[model samples]
Target: MAFIFESDLKAFLFCLLQFVIAIVVSYSFSNYTNPEQRKLEKVAMLELKVEQTEKDIEQLRDLTRSLEGKYQNIESVHVPLVAFHVYNPLHTNLEVGQVIVYQTVPLNEGNGYDRKTGIFTTPVTGLYQFSAHICNQDNAMFVYAIVLEGETIALSTQRDMPSSCNTVNALTVASAGQQVSVQGVHMSKSYQVIENPHRKNSFNGVLLHRT
Candidate 1:
């Protein structure tokens, strides 16, 4: 009886060991032989990533195309607004009320602002480039380049020391009309007409340019 019980116990232990071994072997074999499953999963992940990349590339292409169209449109128009005023020799001492026309005027009264001498208001919307020169008047004479958009100062320069009489100083403005002016004491004693008398005072309007 003792021998039979011992034999039974031995058989049971052996069976349990075999079952554990079989389970381990089956699990290992399943992982090894089915590498294709893992490969398929990797391929699916790669395909998904590639699809996302393609979508991103498409979006970038669209942005580039849109920018190109705008760039072309900008390239077409290229007009610049140019403005120049002649220095006045008689401007030895410009008084408070002394007024001068810097550009040509139509039948209408030109819109010129006298915040200071050598300055004018823009009557129309357009690019307004400004320039000026002074002569005879030494360091004592000065030309102030005060360019304004509405009441905003876009550019300002004071030519306290100028070399030539016909020297040129300038500024540019946008829109049909705006206000621009210079600040300086002119040689009120004497003045000369600019070569282009039409654009002498505040008569000439600047041309609009596409940037």
Candidate 2:
């Protein structure tokens, strides 16, 4: 009886050892067999993480600037006084020489932009940067001109289907009360058409350096 019991225990121990060996072999085949592939995957993942981190940092910086513009008075620091962001949800139809008016004004520091006139008048003499974004309706095309002091500095166009949006930015020197706006160009050409209401067509400006 004692011999039979010992024989049964040895058989059980042998089976256990075989099971452990099989598990270890399977693990090695899945992981260690393709070391280069695993290394490449790790590298790709790291690069993607780094790229996303950079974008997050940039977005945070932009938010910080926007917040500073919101809370701080223009005179609080000598940094800058003129800054604004405005968008339009009205007046999609347009004609030649018509100015684009953005009715909504979210950030207007130093009272530089007029939501009524669709123009930005500088509050302080400095170098200014202006941006205009246009969105065309599904079956139309619209062209816009970024006018600084009544001179076209930049132009952009958007079409109905394939390309539905475009943007134009301008950098110019101006003084207090100098006008900056977007206008129709008669096709140089430009004529405004109905714009997509779902898209936010925008005009924004910022004072870069004080002269």
- Shift in Å, residue 2, candidate 2: 99
Across 103-207, the per-residue lDDT of candidate 1 in tens digits comes to: 322322343433234355555555555544433333443333334543433222223343234434454644544455443433322332223332233323344
**What is candidate 2's TM-score against the reference?**
0.57
Root-mean-square deviation per candidate: 13.3, 24.0
Q: Name the runs in model 2 displaced over 4 angstroms.
A: 1-77, 160-163, 187-198
Model 1 reaches what TM-score against the true structure? 0.35
Residues 1-211 of candidate 2: C-alpha lDDT, one tens digit per residue: 9999999999999999999999999998878768978889999999999999999999999999998887765544365667899886457667877887888888999887777788888887888888888876664666779898888889976665643677888888888778888887653213344445556788888988877
Prediction 1 global C-alpha lDDT = 0.49
Please tell me which predicted candidate would have the highest lDDT against the true structure. 2
- CA lDDT of each prediction against the hidden true structure: 0.49, 0.79
Candidate 1 wrong stretches, greater than 4 Å: 80-211
How many clashing residue pairs, candidate 2? 2
TM-scores for all predictions = 0.35, 0.57
The per-residue C-alpha lDDT of model 1 at residue 33 equals 75
